[model samples]
Target chain A: MWRCLLLLCFATSAAAGKPDPQRQRELRSLLKNDCGACHGLTRKGGLGPPLLPEALAGKSDAELLRTIQEGRPGTAMPPWKPFVDADETLWLIEELLRKQPVSMEHGG
Target chain B: MIEINKSIDKSVPLLLLLLYLLGNVCLAELRGSGDLGVVIERERGSVLIIETSKRSILARVEKLGDLSHASVVFSRDQRYAYVFGRDGGLSKIDLLQDKLVRRVVQAGNSIGGAISQDGRFIAVANYQPGGVKIFTSDTLELVADIPAVYGDDKRSRVVGLVDAPGRQFVYSLFDAGEIWLLDMRDPSRIEIQKFSDIGRQPYDALLTPDGRYYLAGLFGESGLALLDLWHPEEGVKRILPEYGKDDEKLPVYKMPHMEGWSVTGNLAFVPAVGLHQVLVIDMLQWRLVKSIPVAGQPVFVMARPDGRQIWVNFAFPDNQQVQVIDVEDLSVSRTLQPGKGVLHMEFTPRGEEVWISVRDDNQILVYDTRSFQEMARLPAVSPSGIFFTSRAAKTGL
Candidate 1:
């Protein structure tokens, strides 16, 4: 019984890692409107630092995720943990790494 | 007979050429003559001149500098638009010619601006270096600069700048929590009226349609600071003092946009900060009448020109939806999913249709107000605010 429970936990964790269309759409809107309000709508930088791939090239994925989750202290960048979860932050980082504009239709 | 026929043919060719030239000129004039509007393309640092009659984008004028939180006010003739950009670049664009007249980088960082009631001067509220700069509307030349000094050389950032009656400009100092009125009747000599301790951190403000009152939203605390422009000697007073005091405050994702509050008839639909509700206030008494629950934090509560329905849009995750509330019933008439990143909405002069900017989708969606049906979509680049020329006729836009 114990062995079976451990296997189930591992399976559920793996499934959570998979992409979710609904969550992707939510994150897309958050990144575009919330983050875009400070950073440029195109991520080219406005009141906040640029999130374009080139501007974030030197930073590692973990560093980006930490910034998105924990937020930089004493900066305009707010921790999105209240709105976004750990896995969603990871997914968001992946999408940001790809440097592709979110498609409205697909997200909807 | 042959000689006469040759002369007639020559005259006919000349007549045709003149007619063709006349037709071209007429077409050009027609293009320039119409109900004009503009959409601020935030990221691209451009403005899209739109002909509202045809529901089409006429031209996209670019290179206006940093337009992150840009705002536009039109000239008296409605032929020119002065754009105030976040990076302190003020640009004047000629609507008729669809070109930039002149642009000046006046400050390090600026929020927004206002034009004088007489259309003679334009004033910008600055964040960096903390002052308000007044410029000549036609020439874009600096006429006066009023530094927001709180005490002994302590500069405070100015916000919520608006034009009032009597060729005056009113703005709030964020750091000082004070409101100042600048009387600019004489360009060289300016009279300043300062009201201190108006609120904790006044963010943005707006003047009533009649220019009777100026309301400023406070960020550091709940409620707002109200100044009866007609009676400035009474000083500023607090309204809705207990708005967020009784409840636990939610983290505000974005400040509630006070400029877009809907004022129709006796009621004003004001967005509640950090709440998914709109506080309806009786304009006559200036008291909160009711709190209407919405989908999320309301960013803009706009009333159709007819004053029958109020349209509300949200910030961030809830920005995808726009809700229309019937004035009589005080209930949501319809909810519209206008696509992702809905930023701003503007109605036609007659209030027949509303143009909404969906920034993430990069399109401006036009919807029929009565039917609540999508009519047209014009492509744009990260569009934000939509302003109509009719606003030039209003007291405080």
Candidate 2:
């Protein structure tokens, strides 16, 4: 029963999305090699929004591409007319929107 | 410009110097000066207001989504106010007209924001794909978008945002042990400083009046973390533990819910959920000096400007009243039963009264702090965050 309780705690924590070592590396790479040039990989955010999952969760693929293609009329998020092909941008947006594990561990 | 003719008097040379300085001061005073009021987000569809005082609501002009939620902020001089909308919409609300005259659709999400101390720029924290977008408060144009990576975990949110003096604005990512500060002096781009070694599940943070330290409240960590602004690389300089004792030793609430520092800049208070108490910390030493026990999962704690009392809102079991705490003695002063669903409280600048947002009851309860008496309850529609402007600084019925 004690083992079961421990397992239960672990399961809940994991479900809440504690950072996984493998996932972090993959996210960092995707952001750096792929999205970094435009959106910026590190502290320096650029023309595009950061690829953090919390920001992309509810945003739809079409909306993301629409923002890229049409460009916001009032702001500087210019239409990515010649920057990149539409399909490639769509694929990148999908990956950016994917949810990662929750990080609820009290490391302190 | 009027030219002042000063005759040279060799005998009273010192008096002439004083007159010259006085003339310059008078010329400077001729320039119009006004009080800066807190700009608040009013969830009235596409419309938001620049509230100068408690009762006065100035409609800000801006092009916004009919369904968009926007956060409004005013320049220090009360000349300009910026409105940030979710999904990259930005608008400038001109204070003089009390209307939003310029709109920038793709600026960034209007989730969290801080106005520059100089009132030249406004920084907004976009919720999705967390990033900070800086805009010129005067022109209402997109200056820069700094990619701000939040919690490694997805549930963490970039909720609380504030601009530290100088040009840097700090973004507090909830449930994440990190905060990102970006310099926005240059409108063309953004400069970033990622401080990831902060306490767990950091919520809101505020700088001391002297601007020496930035204190942040952490959830689940049971402590408040202090960061030295001069050295961002130093990480958390001090950790003040929050207090709570579970009589049953059974797990109920997860951690500390919401915390607020007093306007007096002396005490830091946290609502210890499930523990039924509010933790008080001395701001200077960063120590948990006392604990004032209270009823049921206390969700929110708010300090009046005088710093004498703290109003706490209990969440679970749906208690209708907000618990009061006396700062001097650190004891439970009185239990106030205002209305159902008393979740959040916003006080006027004078600290004369507090307006409590009762969600389910759909009303904002106005109360007198001195008598602990309920004054008048204004009907509201799903009020979550209650804010008052400098114009509406008095407790009204």
Candidate 3:
């Protein structure tokens, strides 16, 4: 019952939690710089594996979501949950999948 | 007979005129490659051959594959630049002709490379096949391939590959946490000396100015592994082991590159991971002396060529701000906001001026080192590494 309640709560937050345009820009920069620090600026893979759509094709959404939240322990991949909330992480992952600008007007 | 003689005389004059023009074209005023460099246009898969003396670009060579993480090593003569592209494309670019002379895809994924001490070989560190590939510097032909094989059929990613004095190449194995010295003095009789358990996850490393000590920065742990090239029997020793233990490990937005770590006298200024500070280490003792507060997590803590000042650029949000650390006082002397996405900075060969690449602004801003005045600006497409021919003479640039 608690798990279901939490899932519903998360769903509601995710539905209402589309980041503002400015926040979207910040997220984009983070994806380019912060994440790019390891995964590479073009997402071709450096110390970490590639985050490009083709690279992420084999990995499941759930797996990526968990990795971003909890972080890979042994590797250089740090837990980004402290900076990015669950809802934003999902949006960022979706942005990576789309491989397009995440601004509201351009998302379509 | 008179008509034929007239035709022959006219043809002889025309031939003489053509020869004179050809001779003039061949004997154009000679120039030098000392001030020439190649600026990487990371996003566009192209390179701009730039001249530092006049602060201008000579030519733009394109179609270098996947340059998102490109690194370059100049030929001994500095006339040619061997660019190591992210997608394993090794391109040899001629600065004088301004063309891609040769390109070879030797690996699946390569990080960076180094020119051998003798400049005869180019050794590349690979992440995919997890080994080092040595090529003949002249032809980019495959000469030797040393796999970082350890612990089962697992091959560790090679990082921190630098040529030590005398036909030697030293590098760190990322996955295996080991350092290996490759002796190619006798190319046919290859010898490898391995140092196991030298800390964890050495992301990158750099050799000292004199090429004596090679230090590898640990990402998995807080310490840096130090290896003295003079004495391999002593093995690798850990330094700055407790740096991270003091503070709660902040999220490292970007990994601090170890390539351009500044060493002025006995002091080495290194970017402390996951923090807004540059750790100053006493090279003589290989110990952390002090941590100077900065604008943000320093990316490249590079010293000026003359070793008077150290300029540091940060990571991500704070990357726009470059702080100058006075080596004498060990304090933050000044900060300059050189627009957004300040990716990399390179001081002129003699350290008179600096050229900074603002990726977001799409401009290379030249600044006078002393006055800190904007000297000139050149347009580019997402420029990253600004390498001068000066690196050709220096070891492990």
Candidate 4:
């Protein structure tokens, strides 16, 4: 019975595009700090291409996910697979698609 | 008849007083002098002129090319500002006239630049073609171009370009892992000194306030390479050996900026990349004495000009906060949440006030250093770096 429950938990998390609140928060920080370095803090373009919703409107979710995992060749953008997993990459794409601002907290 | 003449005399004086006040307002607008500074509008490719005394915005000049990573160095007279844009455009603007005097695209892509000690030449470090270009400060004309060649490749991104004493410029090459000194006292005959294999990847470097030592941060390794600029023949040596060697390396969200690293008295505060700590170094021994852990990954570890306290800001999840470290104890005295996206900070010349740029909030907040109380708030458009003309008189600014 314990094994069955454990399998069910794993299956649920393995589902594609499943939303996890804890993972979402971590991904938001990554997008705001890591990606935001080149892509402006406000998601406007900087040294790299802009990641705004309007800019990503034409690109599909699969395309965006692939780029995040594999990165663009011959550019400053490096593959983020080492840091973020596949599911988290999708979550980041959806966050970018929705144009959600990273909710920041006060000082620790 | 006597009453009508008295009324006319009073009305004439009132009209003259109004005219005099209007003239004074126009004159102040035209003069454009006083304690002045600039805020780099990163995405908009513009700079906003600010009156430091009034804590107000004077004007915004646009059309500075790809300013995603722009920096400015003022002329000796402090009347002109030389802006180095990321797209390799160097523009000289007259602050009094509020106009661009001259602009030239000198390279394919550039990072930051510095003005010579004599203020006669401006040197820009290029990333695309991988070299350093020197231009006449007055004309923006190319005086020398030295390619950062390593092995067989003729291109290596040059970073950490700073002007030193004796009409010389020193910089580090990222791809080549080298530090070079270029002497341009005689533009007709330039002298170059190359110190190769300084480290793995020197992302940024800074010179001491007294112009004695030049320290380069190695991104590809655990330690930093230091060069004694006063005695160039001694060569480069690694300091703080084995730093971060015992810990698992975390993904670096953004590179720690050595330009903002501060040295006060006998200690230097260095922001360690991928770590939530600021390494306090004993300058005399050139060794890491302690690591003060903070909120998150540290970006800029700037010291107050008075050398009493150090201010620190972080990256990503912790970027909204700023911390004050008391220099005497090497401990955090206070933590401040200035605003969202706290990008950069600059202090007044005398360390009376600190101006912080909140990019997401689009506001520049000035606080009294002693009380940490908000003194003024000026609207800005995604401001990043705040600079003052007072930096013009200081070395290694």
- The share of true interface contacts that also appear in candidate 3 amounts to 0.39
- Flag clash pairs in model 3: none
In candidate 4, what are the lDDT values of residues B70-108, reduced to their tens digit? 788888888888888777789888777677889999886
Better of 1 and 4 by lDDT: 1
* CAPRI quality of model 1: incorrect
Q: What share of the true interface contacts does each candidate keep?
A: 0.16, 0.00, 0.39, 0.11
Could you tell which candidate, 1 or 2, scores higher by lDDT?
1
Name the candidate that leads on TM-score.
3
Query: Model 3 over residues B157-253: C-alpha lDDT tens digits?
Result: 9998888887888999999999999998997787999999998888889898888899998888888999999998999998988887879776776
TM-scores of the candidates in the order shown: 0.82, 0.61, 0.91, 0.80
TM match of model 4 to true structure: 0.80
lDDT of 2 by residue, B361-381 (tens): 666677888987777765554
Identify the CAPRI category of the predicted complex in candidate 2: incorrect
Question: What lDDT would each prediction earn against the true structure?
Answer: 0.82, 0.55, 0.86, 0.81
Off by over 4 Å in 3: A1-8, A11-15, A20-26, A53-63, A81-85, A99-108, B1-19, B26-29
Stretches > 4 Å off in candidate 4 = A1-108, B1-34
Which sequence of candidate numbers ranks them by TM-score, best first?
A: 3, 1, 4, 2
Q: Write the per-residue lDDT of candidate 2 for residues A1-108, one digit (tens) a residue.
A: 774464444334443553357755644443342343234323123334565777676875656666755566533244554544455455445556654311111100
Judged by lDDT relative to the true structure, which candidate is superior, 1 or 3?
A: 3
In the range B270-324, model 1's lDDT, one tens digit per residue, is 7887788888888788898888888988888898988899999997668889999
- Report lDDT (Cα) of residue B91, candidate 1: 97
